[model samples]
Target: MEVTTLTRVYRYDGIDLPVPPHLAGDPSALRAYHATLYPAILNAEAVDLGVSNGALVTEYRRAVGTKGR
Candidate 1:
């Protein structure tokens, strides 16, 4: 028999969120949600990493305006 282990990591306020039952049991759903959420999460992380909130907001506005064209 082969055994495998899976790990998921999330940080919140310098602490970790507990793994939910859905994520632990359904790998595909977890993967899909992660993919959908990744961009927003990464953008927030970039904002935290020294990018000013005003700059981030302005960039987001520009992106939306460009996409609306």
Candidate 2:
């Protein structure tokens, strides 16, 4: 049987945070877990960076305000 493994990485604050295996497949759960680690991530947007090097890269970008202009 052919087996494939998925590696998930969370890019935030100019650092790469490896996602926990248990929360890898669950986006909501993953986000919640990350929020616990980085409260700012609660408002961050998850931007999928697509797969590279057999790993899934996701970036959590904080929302920027436009000064209500």
Q: Give per-model TM-scores.
A: 0.27, 0.75
Query: What are the Cα lDDT values of the candidates?
Result: 0.38, 0.86
Query: Candidate 2, which ten residues in sequence have the lowest lDDT sum?
Result: 16-25
- For 1-69, candidate 2 gives per-residue lDDT tens digits of 998886888889888876787887898998888888898899899999999899888899999987564
Which regions in candidate 2 have their CA more than 4 angstroms from the true location? 1-5, 66-69
Candidate 1 per-residue lDDT, tens place, 12-60, comes to 3443334477675574454445436344432233112222422211111
RMSD of 2: 2.6
The runs of at least 3 residues in candidate 1 whose Cα sits more than 4 Å from the true structure, single-residue gaps closed, are: 1-4, 24-43, 46-69
| TM match of model 1 to true structure | 0.27
